[model samples]
Target chain A: MSSSSAAPGRGDGAEKPPMRDALVAAAFRLFLERGYEQTTVDDVVALAGVGRRSFFRCFPSEDDAVFPDHERCLADMTAFLAAGADDEPVRRVCAAARPVLRMHAENPAFSVRRYRLTESVPGLRAYESSVVRRYERAPAGYLRARFAGPRDGALRADVIAAAVVAAHHNALRSWLRSDGKGDAEAAVDHALGQVRAAFGAGPVAAAGKGPEDVVVVVSRRGAPLWRVVQELETALGRG
Target chain B: MSSSSAAPGRGDGAEKPPMRDALVAAAFRLFLERGYEQTTVDDVVALAGVGRRSFFRCFPSEDDAVFPDHERCLADMTAFLAAGADDEPVRRVCAAARPVLRMHAENPAFSVRRYRLTESVPGLRAYESSVVRRYERAPAGYLRARFAGPRDGALRADVIAAAVVAAHHNALRSWLRSDGKGDAEAAVDHALGQVRAAFGAGPVAAAGKGPEDVVVVVSRRGAPLWRVVQELETALGRG
Candidate 1:
């Protein structure tokens, strides 16, 4: 998407430690200077002062270098969830969602840059979807394990995971739209809190009295709306 | 990715007034027979016995032809939601979600084939994400409009939309994993019902008193957990 290809970073920050970081930084430098598809691994290694083995070691493809922090963030999130005590599951997952938002907040310029770069390329947009799906799986795995007993546990896990991710992104979008100048943590916390309020163990459960006696209605699956309403009315003793 | 590149269909079902459908059928035959990359617009037109204009009229890109029915399904869903009269919005969105699942169910083999085809191609998988986003936006738009009053209304709408979509797909995946042989409607209804339970205007409201008085514990937005719990216990007169 950038206008022209240029020789980028001839021996800039070549002495950096952690060969992986050097390769990714150099890749992003060249990737921005000389569009995504136009740059090659050879070009990246030359600027990075690393070997092709090192380049491949750091990135799957040129586009993948744009998101260099997801693996670390995902690992930290997994470890955080794994170390958690038996807190409420919905609250726990909402807690687990913070590290991801914080990861983006840590480097607004980099994320903003990557955001614009990704929006410009169809291939990168596709690649972004794959990256997102990877993050979605972590919370989903934790919830699936926690909610394993119910028949709908897996479905619940998937829905809650998706809700968390969607809410997280919704908040992040506002922060990024402000060019990363807004309070990301507050926005994300507020958004995830909404998810918790909806899916969390409710005030009824928190009060330690069961919710069933309040009202209960049962209807066969695939019943018509009228029939289901009739069943509910009958349950309320009003039919 | 199909194995080899070869010429495909010549004048099969050319008389169909639904020129769009024929063009897509022809494109798929060639895309599967040859490779997706190997097939070109010119080749598709030659095989379908249609002019180049017709092919371009029907699809945006070569990959766009795969999801032939989404626009129609989206229109039907939008109309269904628009026509809904004063129903509970969460349940309305869930009810609105069915036609999309049914659209896929209407043609199991075609969906099964598209599923396999999409999985085999990364670009198609990316395209699938865009298509799914389109569907997600429908429920999201409806919810945003309906819940427009509160400050968090938009965020609530978004996460709920994502939850419904995730549940819908979870059930759809079961049906698709069965090679589209499973009962998609029953599965989807069950999944969406879970969403309804989580987000519905509860039986408390149905019992005709607002849900506000069940256990009201007011706390500041950014209050610490202990402070909030202290406030809650004070509200319950146990402080």
Candidate 2:
């Protein structure tokens, strides 16, 4: 909708546009045409019909322009995780990833273009990695606080948090690599399902030995009896 | 050993000292004394008694000096993983992390100091995240290639790779935060053990069902029998 309003560089006769939108549109256009490195802050402002002060007000630097919405998305994710229930921490974290997925899905062309650009640029790749880590930390920090215990709870929190982020990225990247075609929601859900299957035991199984105990192991139906017994023992922490 | 020969800036008599080492020493000294931002490349060259050419030859930038050995360690890890047998991808990846732990362990004082410095500097933290992501990619790429099959193998590979890195960082950070005191090897091993338990099933268990199957589930001793049955069914993929 914003793109149709006025051409990026061409100052179409209209009321003064939103500076942030104009700057972002101009920056992305310049980046795609001349490459990220070749495009400068002045180029962005010149195209947007703005000055250096306006550009700096919108973005800290040229690199920040490439990822204009990360701060907003990160804040939303942190707030989502903060509002999660004490129970089902893993599920809550998984749910928190939805907004991110939606943000990309809402703008498929931009997401795909950004993904390709990031893949080609080392600095952008590094900056993207930091952004990804911040997202990971939000969930991991939440889980760490919720699962604060002397046992392996802290480790579990970190592992599950990393796993969730990995799965989300896996699904999202696959969709992006496909140029944003196909059912991204289903792809994300399927990926999340695998995470749940792998780590969805929740606090119940993690508590490991209430007053009573039950041990179940899954292996090949035709597995040798001894192997089954050994697996059971291993699962029970005996072997 | 290098530290004992001469004070970093004093330049004690020694024929043709290693320019790389000298630059690093000078840079760290200045960084400590004046803070990372306050120190300049000229200051480092002046203290090291080296030219700008020599400093640039040794380090691409000031940040690169802070992580002098990452390239060598990364190469070592890649070679270790490359030599791995096809059947034990998880174990091989786990083994690949050992050298990194050893790198930190070999220089406790330097590692602790670098940890403190990185903790205080946002630039360094972002740089470190990028470094950590590189390490994560090596193992994840290995697993993705090895687990190149259906049934969430890619997802599993990515998740496990992330989990291993997270566990390693958790253990390493705890040790560094303690000023590198205590048994870091044992701590890393324990952390890796949790990763193995949580995600060690590898591609074999990940294959789902074979000709036959056995399902095992463990619950608290006092858990209801029905809950045990339900968990067993879920583990068996029936529920």
Question: What's the lDDT for all of these models?
Answer: 0.70, 0.75
lDDT by residue (tens digit), candidate 1, A22-133? 6667777776788888888899888878788877777776766667667767888898888775877777888888878877776677667677777787767777776676
Highest lDDT: which candidate?
2
Lowest-scoring 10 consecutive residues by lDDT in candidate 2 chain B? Answer: B4-13
Interface RMSD of 2: 7.5
What docking grade applies to model 2?
acceptable
Model 2 lDDT, full chain set: 0.75
Assess the local accuracy of residue B113 in candidate 1 as a C-alpha lDDT between 0 and 100.
77
TM-scores (chain A) of the candidates: 0.75, 0.78
Clash pairs (backbone) in predicted model 1: none
DockQ (0 to 1) for model 2: 0.38
**Per-chain TM-score, chain A, candidate 1:** 0.75
The digit string of per-residue lDDT tens for model 1 on B146-169 reads 889978788878888989999998
RMSD of each: 10.1, 8.0
